[model samples]
Each structure stands twice: as structure tokens, then as C-alpha cells.
Target chain A: MMTDLPLDQVRTLLAVVDEGTFDAAAAALHVTPSAISQRVKALEQRTGRVLLLRTKPVRPTESGEVLVRLARQVARLEHDAQAELGLSGEGEPTRVSVAVNADSLATWFLQVLTRVPEEFRLCFELRREDEDHTAALLREGTVMAAVTSSPDPVPGCSVRSLGRMRYLAVAAPKFAARHLGGPVARTLTEVPVVVFDRRDDFQDGFVRGLTRGRAGASALRHYVPTSEGFVEAVAAGLGWGLVPEPQADPLLGDGRLVGIAPGRRVDVPLYWQQWKLDSPALVQVAETVTATAAEALRP
Target chain B: MMTDLPLDQVRTLLAVVDEGTFDAAAAALHVTPSAISQRVKALEQRTGRVLLLRTKPVRPTESGEVLVRLARQVARLEHDAQAELGLSGEGEPTRVSVAVNADSLATWFLQVLTRVPEEFRLCFELRREDEDHTAALLREGTVMAAVTSSPDPVPGCSVRSLGRMRYLAVAAPKFAARHLGGPVARTLTEVPVVVFDRRDDFQDGFVRGLTRGRAGASALRHYVPTSEGFVEAVAAGLGWGLVPEPQADPLLGDGRLVGIAPGRRVDVPLYWQQWKLDSPALVQVAETVTATAAEALRP
Candidate 1:
């Protein structure tokens, strides 16, 4: 089956998907539109599956997504090979893209980038997504690696434990006095809250755990998507929230933020997942990230 | 026709879209599955078009999206009315959701939030998307306002000119000497560049402007998704890029970075857009944002 798939046909399919149309793909690849169409048709014939939904700016069918993933993996391997063989253009930097959570980006991830040897001349492309969703980027082949909450590896990737990131339920002193001074769980469900985003469940989960599933954070919520700003929002008495320890510590020490639920915290376990490849650059990044995570996150 | 479209039915449509399933929507709305089905049927009858694509997890058709947007607007109006009438729950903060770009968020947008009067007790929910895309959130009714690049207003929203955000092409002095010593326009096409993300076109636009559309920024690019980090990456000599003037000035003055093309700059005109509602809270926010933008950005 591997022998049956030709690289050229697979590449044409990828170009078509990326360019959004056969003509655009042809223009990008410097090939005729008919040639792009023929190669895609040939790939479909070989695979025995309809690969694309021919819409305005075509979309990949489920089967096409699988092939697109394979194509990207192959491209990554080829690019690594060229770099290793010294066939790459002079001053060409090896690019590695990763999807990271916002908290990780703001806190310790930049430190990991600094740890990678500068001799590699690596270029980094970072995507910010939720920890729960970063793995999806890896699965879609949009990123070569990810800092994700999922323990399960993306198909061709390997996962390693990157310690737990702890969040402390916090509020401003005045806010705690007014809203959170009552029954902790019940009042939490009734008072205004701060969430990271619409998808953020950290506060609700904290409330649920506190109330034994009887309550969740109030719907009157402020969603401040950035990690640093989210901490600031809570400290400014906008609403109580579960803030990452790294971000919450300074404010807590300065009396800007107070722990609403003392001794109660949420620890979200994170994992580093990367393509299972022998690329030295990728290995360097993974090792640096793993080492940094070990020191920065709770064990 | 507007009277015929009941609020409950419109809200039910939004719930179905949000929850992604009829049963989930039913549970959320505290109604039975049969009631959800009937309400949806009545809505389709009233609209004379199928509003939903009843897949495993429901999806809204084009007409459904229209009604979902309407439902959100109505909710915003109702919430504003309650606040004005003092019928809101005690200590309920006036909530305002705004979609802002990361650059604006990092630079001057947060200041606008601080300028809001404490008496209003506004709870801000900020969504950080690219400036070019923030208006989509407004159109979808996910956000009540946005900071956008486009001067054109999202339907039902009014627009106000903020000012032009100037971006200067810059690099570390060492990097400029090494790679940018030749003809500025030609060398830029060959040298590595730092881009904000895949969607970023500022660098390419700069190169195009420099070369009279004959060239573009290098394909050898580092994609740093965050605004502050993008500046840091450029200052650290990863690659040259079009840095926002507000962020670039400090680094350049400190000798960490230098202008690659001394006088070359791109000015992206920004605008403040918000729902055309008489909510004092939204108006206060708009006024503060516009005032700040006037001071902080180039008119």
C-alpha cells in the first residue's frame, strides 16, 4: 500500500488543498491546471476514495484529510533530510511549528525556546490554542508538535509527561469579602466569575469539585483570553477565577489577589507530544521543553 | 413578521446551534426533546425555510445563522434594558464582550478597559483574534464590539476611526549588517523575516511596497503568534519584520534593534466598531477606546 502511493500525486493533492483550487495550485506549483487535476484524480483512483469536496475553494473530505496529514508528514521528513544533507539554501533556517496553550506561551514556553542551541539556526512558528485543543492541531498536521492536555498521542506522534500546571482559585480581597465570604461552593455558583474563554471549564470544574457536582461557576462571567490579562482581571476584582500558579503567585504575595478557596487548587496535567521522527532539531526542542516543564510545572 | 418570530423560538435556535444537538439543547433549555422538535418546526414554518441541518450534532443553515444572530442581539438588548431598569440581580455587573486583535490587546487596548468608570461596574469579556477577523465575531454576535482593520461596519454596528497603527521594518543591528547590507528591497526577499502568523501580510506588503510589487518577504520566516513575543523574536535577531511602532521604538532606542529601512513604514488604519445600542456601558467603552487610540496611534 505504501508503494502504491506516489509522492508527486500526494504532493499535488496537498497543493490543491492549500491553494484552494486547481488553478491556484497549478500557479503555486508552476504546473498546468489540467496537470494538477490529473494528479489529484490519479491519487483518488489509487486510493479508491473520493478525496475532495469540489466547493468554492475546495474542502478535503474525511479521506482527503487523512492523505493531507500523510503529505505533511512526508514534507516534514523531506525538509529535515534536505537540512541534514546540506542541500538546503544557504542561511535557510529549519522551521518547527508547535501549538501551545496561552498560559504555557506566557509563562515557561519562551524559556524552552531559549534553551535550544542557537547553532541549529531554528525558526519557530508558534500557534496559541487551549491545551485541550492543541492536540487537534497536531492531528490535523497543522503543527509538528504540541503542548496538550491529552495523554493520548496523535497518530504518528509520541507523548511524554510534562508535569501538571496548578491553578489556584483566587479573587481580590474586596471581592472575596463581598461575594465569596458566604458558603464557598454555593456563593461561587451565584456570584460573577472570570473564565479564560468560552471553552474554559477550569472555574466550573473547580466549583463542581468543591460542591460535589452540585454547582458550577456563575454565568455572569468575564472571558479574558490572555493568561496574563486573565490574572489581572481577577486581581482587579472583576471576578474570581482559577489562575495558573506562575501567574497568581506575585499578585497573591502583593495582596492584589487573595485565595478564595485556600488549600484547594486545580492541577491540569500537561503532556509534550511531537512527531515520532529522528530529526535532531525536533529532539532538541522536545528535550529542552521537557526539562523546562519539569522545573516550572508541579510534579 | 418580527412579532411572529417569538423570542423563545429564536433563543431555542441559538441553543440548538450552541449545544450542537437537539437533546443537548433540550437539556440546556430545560425542555423535553418533543418540545424542542416542535419549536424548531414552528420556526421553520414561520421562516418558510429549514433553519437547521439536523445532523448528529445540529448545524445552523444560512437562514439559521441569521436568526441566531438576531437572538443574540435581542439578548443583548434585553440585558441592557434590565440593567437600565435596575431589574438585574443585585451586584450584577454590566457585561460587554469585545473581540480585539492581539497587538491592540498587548499595546493600548487594555488601557481602554481601565478607563471605564467604576460606577458602571462593567464586566469585560475580551476575545483576542486578528484585527482582520475581529469583525466576524461581531457579525456572528459572539462579541458586542470589536477593534477591526476594516472601516466598513458589521451590519447593525456603528464604526469610529481609531487611527493608523504604524509598522516599521526593523532588525537587530548585527542581523542588518550581515543579511541586509545589499539593496534593501532585493535583500529583504532573500533574508529571513519574522511574521506574526500565517495570516499576517504586513511584512509581505512592506516588501511589495519597497520593490513596487516586484518582490515579497522571504519564505524563510519565523512565525511568532504573539505581538510582544514577535517583537522580542526580532530583537533577539531571529529575523527582521514590520514591528508595530509603539513596540519597536523602545527596542530601537535601546540599541537592541535598528531600522532596516529608515523611513519605510506601513500604517494600518484601525476602527472601533460596536452594536448600535443605547447601552451606556458600551458607549463609555467606545468613547474611552477611541480617545486612547487617538493618543496612542498615528492619525
Candidate 2:
């Protein structure tokens, strides 16, 4: 079934998706816009699927995403072959991109790079997104690998458990004393809370568990989007939040922050997903990242 | 022409796109999947255009994006009307979502939140994206407003100049003495640089300017995705990179960081863009954000 798909059309589909317009894709692929259009049309006819939405910045239909993923895998294989064959262009560093969550990027991801041998001569591009959405990049063929919360493999990728990342509900000592002096569940609903963003529901989920799903975190919440700054905001006595365990440790020990629910915490299971290809660079990254996660994260 | 598009069908179409699947959209809209399919099909028939690509997660066609924008405008108007007539649901906070860059989020953006009047009962949802891409959220209706690098307004939105964010080429004193003790242009390519991520080119641009466009910053760069952390990494002597002027001031004043290039700097002009509607909540937020940016950023 896969053999029926033409390589040029698949690569053209990826170019159009990446460049966002037929004209731009043509410029990127060094062809005419009409050529780009005809190629896409031919590919759609061949696949018997509507491949694109043709938006201002073009969006791939689900069918198009499949082809885009295939294009990336092919590109990865070609790059690896070039590298192994000593045919890589002079001084052209091999570039690898990975999508990672903010918490992991802030906490322990750098150590992975340190472990990479200088001999690898690789350049890394990191995309910071939420753990739940990191896999979307892999699905889109934007990143070769991702540190994602989903255990499910993005088709063509293999998944391995990286263990659970624990989070603690904590607040500045002064803030807890001032605003959280009452009953845990009810008081949480009344007091101000800090969240990573509107999409962040960890604190609300924690509150719901305590209140039997009767209430949510306060509507009067502070949206601090960065992981490091989120902890800083909580420690600065702005609001209480569910802070990642490692980030909260020093603050908790130094009394800058106090655990409100010492017995309650959230453990988000993380997984490392990468393309199932025989590429040395990708293999080294996976091994290094997995090894670091094992040491830094709780199983 | 506007009357031709039924409000229910329009809303349902938005639901389908947002929810990603027909079944999910039906569940979200509290209707059967068959009903959702019928509404969308009817809408497409009336418009004489294919509105969606029926894939796993359906994508809105270009024409569909137009209707989605219309649906969002209608929703905003309805919410504003309810608020004005004092018919808003009990304890319903006026929610305002804004997309901003990391530098703004870490620095002056929070000040806008602090200035929101308590009487307004506003809930802010800040979406942190790159400044160049934040306007896409506005265009997609994911955010009501955005701080963008481009002055061009998204359709159905207005734009205002927010002034320039200056970035200085900086490094730790020890790093500068150790690695950058030679000619500025050529040495910059040899020394490691710190960048916010792969998309970051400020350091490369700085180096290119010095070298008459013959070179770029080192490929041996450290990728730090957070603004604050990027500065900290540079100050820790990991690499030399461009630091936002405001964030770099204290470090420069304290001698933790040194200017790599005395005169060379990058000034990224920013602008605020928002929906062109007369909602009091939106108006208040715009005024607050604009006033704060005027004070905090350079014109």
C-alpha cells in the first residue's frame, strides 16, 4: 500500500505544509506555483483523499499528516545515510529537533545535551510545548522525537516510559497563612491560585479530588506560563499552585514555600517517543534522555 | 450575505473544528453526531463551498476559517451584550485571553493584569508564544488579543504600536575574556552562543552585522528556551548571546554580564492587536496593556 505513494508528491505535500502556501512551497522547492499545485492535485488523486485545507497558512488534512510524517522519516533516513557514507556536505552540522515540555526542559533536559559526545557534531533545536501536546509535533513531522505525556506511539514512532513527574501543591508560607487558613477544599476555591496557563488544569484537578468534584480552583487565578517563573510566582507569595516536585524541593526546604496538601500530589507519567529508524543521532539522543530521565524522575 | 449563514450551524461548525472529531463535537455541543454532520453539511450546501476536510481531526477549509472567525465575533458580541444587560450567569467572570511572548510575559505583561479593576471581575488567560507567531492565535480565535512583532492586524482586528524591545549582545565577563578576546566579527563565529531556541537568530544576526554578512553566530550554541533562563545561562558562562535590554540591565549593572559588542543591538518592534469590537472588558484590557507598554518599552 505504501509503495503506491510517490516520493516526490509526498515531499511536495510536506513542503506545502511547512511553507504554508503553494507559492511559498514552490519558492522553497524551487519550482513554479503551478507545478506545486499540479503536484498536490496529482497526489490527492493518487491517494483518493483531500490532502489540504488550503488556508492562508495551509493546514494538512489528516490524510496529508500521514504523508508528511512519511516524508520526515524518509528525510531522516537520507540524512543518516549521508552521514554514514561520509557524504555530508563540508562542515554541515547534523541538526536534530525535538519537542519537549517546559517542565522537563527547565528541570533536567540540559543534562542530556551535556552527555552527548562532542564527537557527534550535532545541533539541537528544542520546541517547548506542554507535555500533552508534544506528540502533536511528532505527528506533524515537525520534530523527530518528543518528550510527551502520552504513552501511545505516534505512528512510525516507538514509545518508552520515562517514569512519572511528581508535582506538589505548595504556596509561600505567608500566602498560605493569609489566604489558606481555613478548610482545605473550600478555602482553595476562595483563594487565588497560580497556573501555568489557562490550559493548565493540574491545580484544579487536585482541588476537585479534594472536594469530590464539587469545586474548581479559584477563578481569580494568575496565569504564569513559564515553568521556572511559575514556581517563582508561587514563592513570591502571589498564589498557591501545584509545583513540580524537583522545582519545589529547595523552596520547600528553605521555607520559601510550604506544602499545603502534604499528603496530596499529582504524578504525571511521561514517555519518550522517537521515530523507529536506525539513525545513530536519534539513538544517542534517546539513550541519553532515557538514562537522564531514569535518574531524575520517579518510577 | 451575513444573514445567509445560520448561527446554530456556524456555532456547530466551530465546535466540530475545535473538538477535532465529529463525535467529539457532537458531545461538546450536546447533540448526536448525525445532527452535527447534518448541520455542517447544510452549512456547506448553503455556502456552496466545502467547509471541512473530513479527516480524523477535521480541518476547516479556508472558507471555513472565515466562518469560524465570524462565529467567534458573534460569541464575543453575545457575551458583551449579556454583560451589559446584567444578564451574565451568576459569578461569571469576564474572561479575556491574550497571547504574548516570553520576554513580555516575564517582564511587563503581568503589570497589565495587576491594573485590571477588581470591579470588572476579569479572568485572564495568557497564552505564551513567540512574538512573531502570537498573532496567529488572534487570527485563529484562540486568543482575543496578542502582542505581536508584526504591525499588520489580523482580519477583524485593530493594531497599535507597542514600541521596540532592545536586545544586547552579552556574555559573562569570564566568558568574554576567555573566548571573545579577539576580533568581534570572526571570534563570534568561533565562540559558543546562547539562544532562546532554534528559531532564535538575534545572535547570528548580530554576528553577521559585524562580519559584513559573511558569518553567523557559532553553531555550537546552547539552546535555552526560557527568557530568564537564557540570560542566567549566559551569565553562568555557558555561552554568549543576545539578552533583552531590560532583563540584561541588572546583570550588566552588577557585572555578572558584559557587553560583547559595545554598539550593536537588535530592536524588535512590537505591537498590540485585538478584535475590533466595543466590549467594555476588551476596551479596558487594551487601554491597560497599551499604557503599560508605553512606560516599559522604548518607542
Candidate 3:
């Protein structure tokens, strides 16, 4: 059957994904739970695809995530557009769409905001995603720009190299002494490790690189997804894993965390990609990000 | 003052710049010209910058583009979100955003529409732009995806090989005879050529490659910006140009145009870049385009 998706219903899907359940989405949207359920069901029927994995807090199916991301991006653009057009309601704020990795979001990506030109009032709607996957957000038109690993330009976007982010394998001195049991490399696989999530693979990649692809990190993995928490867990001697240079540096200095591999480090190059439109705000952002990366990342 | 630019206003600003006038943008947006004017003024005040260089069809100042892009991206996400949410208006169809080069649009890009999944039931909002510059649309989130010349992926998107698009140096038999009276290398500089616009450098680049940077193509140029018109202009003996294989094929077969540089040809590599969204619709599109390109473009 011929069907068209309304803007508000899409926004509702985003609300459900973000809020985690129909009840919460209903409360957020100021609609009833029944309305939320019906809306989601309608979406599924229209696309003939299952959108949500109905669990405790409703998690979006892959299709649902596409829509969730789409919703957030729409809200953000609508806000920016309204402001550009000087159309604003007293209570409504402009939403800016940005794609950032979960690590950056939990770390210093927010600092990018502190640098925004304050004279031009703008609100931000941030999309937390894997940096490796953030560019997909741009392709789906989910965000205006993104922080990504690829140096190649996205369709219709210009690219600037941001530089590499270095990571070190470290753990608290006490924990290392207990779990690592002296020679670090020899016993790493035997010791338990902390992983950010099932998607976490840095530890495995590092081990593979070290062992020439013979092994992966310990299978006894503790899933701690938050950046701050992951760092803390490693600092608490939970497991040895990759940590950003800056975070590892202070801890190394204070003798809190000891590096298993002191000098050898892996550097993941980062790049800033944005649409080629000559938008004043995006340019300002690209400039700021470029400047920041110059200082914070490897040359 | 602390100002937040709304997404819709930013979008309207882009529409004005793209359409080249407030009234045209109004028509495109289904709003009155007064509303368009007011929106732009608000954006200017909020940014505390003169964003638009107001003229017959106003142009955005360097500052204005940032907001415009943000708006377009939001619109794209809105489209995607609406599709996922299945919110339909009585007859309004969901629009899909794509960034395509003028040459491709003039040739086979439209054919992609026939291959789309019938369930998508979408409208096409194709942005006419240069291939070299199409990636900018992805970065700005103006379109969900684009066909670009860069081999690299955009910041937050993935890249797939589409293959090289070959361009042949051809001229109308009359134009070639007049302009290329002597050895082409020696006389091409004085010969007039057809170009897309002021920024177009295809013919000049072709000349430079042949001449080892000693000289550029004709200083005298006839700007026939449209691809079909550009080819027609050349066939009508206006000047020589680098024509895409498809457009130049029929003309060459019929003897309307002749190749100037027999062995010298330019093969520009094209790629498909899109947001890394985990959506089936986008993935399907990318696959279809890649498969098509595999057959159509040079390996």
C-alpha cells in the first residue's frame, strides 16, 4: 500500500529509542503509552520490518535505530533551520545534529561545544555512536558532520585530517602485580580483562598485533562501557586494556597505573568530515576541531 | 545574546541560496516570501553576523552557509525518520536526498530510480552539483548520500568503489578545424573551449596534462554550464570540451564530434559515500549503485 511517514511520528520513534520504553517515550512526548505503542506498530507495518526488540526498556531493531537516529537529526536540523529563519517559540530551542563516538562523548567531545561562537545562540543534540560508525550517521543524513577514523571525504563532504589518538596498555600497579603475575606479555591471556562492551575489540586487536595474530585477550571479560568507568576499572586493576594517552599519562605519572608496554603505543588517526556546504557554523566547528586535534592528537 | 539557531530557519536559508532567491525558496518551501525574509533576518541577528549578501537572489555571506547546511541535514534526517516512523500524509510522499553531479544527472543517474525497491515509495530531491564537490553535500548532511570522485570515505561514512568515469577530448568537426589549425599542443591555448562555469577546470586540466603544465586550455571560453547543452554547444562547433563517455559516444559514432587527443583521455575515479547508518534502505541503495557502476564504469 502507498504510505508516507509523518515528521512527528518519526520524532516519536526517536523518543522511544532514547527514553527506552513506550511508557517513558509517552511521558517524554506527552502522549499516552497506547499512542506510543500504536505509532511504533504502524511504523513496523509500513516498512514491513520489525523496528524494535521489545525488551525491558525497548531497544530499537537495526531498522529502528536508523529511524531513531533520523529522528534526532531532524530535530537538530529543524532547530538550526528555525534559527536561521528567525523562527523560534519561547520554549523551543534550536537543535544541532552532531555525530561523535561514545568515547569522545564520555571524554572531551563536549569541549567542542564550549568553543562554539556564543553570540549565535544554538542548542546541541548530540548523537553518541562508535567513531568507526559515525560516518554512517552522515550518510543517512542523521548528523551535519562527524568525528571519524576515515580520511576519505563522505559524499558531498570535505575532509581534514585530525591526527592520531594514541593508546597504551596499562593497569593499576597492584592489580598488575596480582593478575599479570610479573612478566606482562607472557601472562596477559591468562589474566581477566575489562572490555567496554561486546563490540569492544581494542584489547583483542592489541593482543593480535603483539602475538602476530596467534591470540586474543582473555575471554574473562568484564563489560564496562563508560569511558570514565572503564578507565577507573583498569586503574583499579580490573584488567589491562587500551587507554588514551592523556588519561594514561597522569595515571602513569602518579604511579597509580603501570604500563605493560611502556613506549610501544598504537595510534588511531582521526579525521574531521563535514558536508561541503559553506555553512558558517560548520566551518567554525571544523576550524575548532582541527585546532584542537592539532594540540591533542599525534602529528 | 545567547542564541540558538533553529533547524528549519537554517534550511530555509540554504533553500534561498540554492534556489538563488527568496521568492524561489519560498515557492520550494511552500511559504510566503515575507516569511522567508523574516527567517533570514532572525538568523543574522542571532549570529550577530550578516549571513546573507542580499541581492536579487540573495547569497549567504561566509557565515550563513554553516546554518544552511545544518538545516539541510536536519531535513534529510527528518525524511529518513518519517519513513521509519511510517507517518504518512494523505498524498505526500517521502523524499530521498541524493547529491549527484550535473553530468551524471544529465546521463544515467536518473535510471537509478527505476531500480529502487518499490516499497521505498519515495520522491527524489536530487541536488545538482559538481562531482568534485558532491562530497560536500554529505558532510553538510544535505543529502543522505552522494556520488563523488574521492576514493576515501567521508568522516562518518563508508566508501565503496564505483569505478572511473572516462572523459574524452572532443570538438565539433568545425570547431576543431578552426581552433586546432596546427599541432593541437601548440595551438590549443588560443582555441576556445566549452566549460560548465567559472570554476570549471576539466578542459584546462586536460590541456595542462597534455602540455606538461606549460599552458592551460583556451583563455577564450563559452560557458555552457548544463551537460547536455555543453555537449550540444560543442557539437554546434562552439568549442572543444571533455565529454563523458556516454554523452560523447553517440556524437562520436555519428561523426558530429571527433576526438582531438587520440590517446590522451582522463579517467576520473568515482566512489559512493554515505553515512554509516545500519539501515537496510541505504545499504540496498549502495549495493544497487555499486552493482550498476561495476557494469557501467571502467574497472
Best by DockQ: 1
Give the poorly placed runs of model 3, Cα more than 4 Å off: A1-299, B1-86, B131-136, B152-155, B177-181
lDDT of 1 by residue, A1-299 (tens): 76678989988888988889999999999999999999999999988999998976997887887778788888878888998788988767788899988888878887766578978878789998876567656765778899988888878799999999998999999999988767788899988788888888889988999999987888778788887777777887878998889989998899999998878988989999988888888989999999999999999
Interface RMSD values for all candidates: 2.4, 2.8, 25.6
In order of appearance, the predictions have TM-scores of 0.89, 0.80, 0.40
- In the order shown, the candidates' DockQ scores are 0.49, 0.32, 0.01
- What is each predicted model's overall lDDT from 0 to 1? 0.85, 0.85, 0.72
Estimate, for each residue in B128-185, the C-alpha lDDT of model 1 and write its tens digit.
Answer: 9876567667776778899888888888789999999998889999889899878999
Winner by TM-score = 1
Off by over 4 Å in 2: A1-90, A139-141, A155-161, A173-175, A189-192, A197-199, A213-223, A232-239, A253-256, A276-280, B1-90, B172-181, B189-201, B212-224, B232-239, B253-256
Query: What clash pairs does model 1 have?
Result: none
* Alpha-carbon DockQ of candidate 1: 0.49
The TM-score, computed over Cα atoms with residue i paired to residue i, of candidate 2 is 0.80
Q: Any residue pairs clashing in model 2, and if so which?
A: none
TM-score of chain A as modeled in candidate 2: 0.96
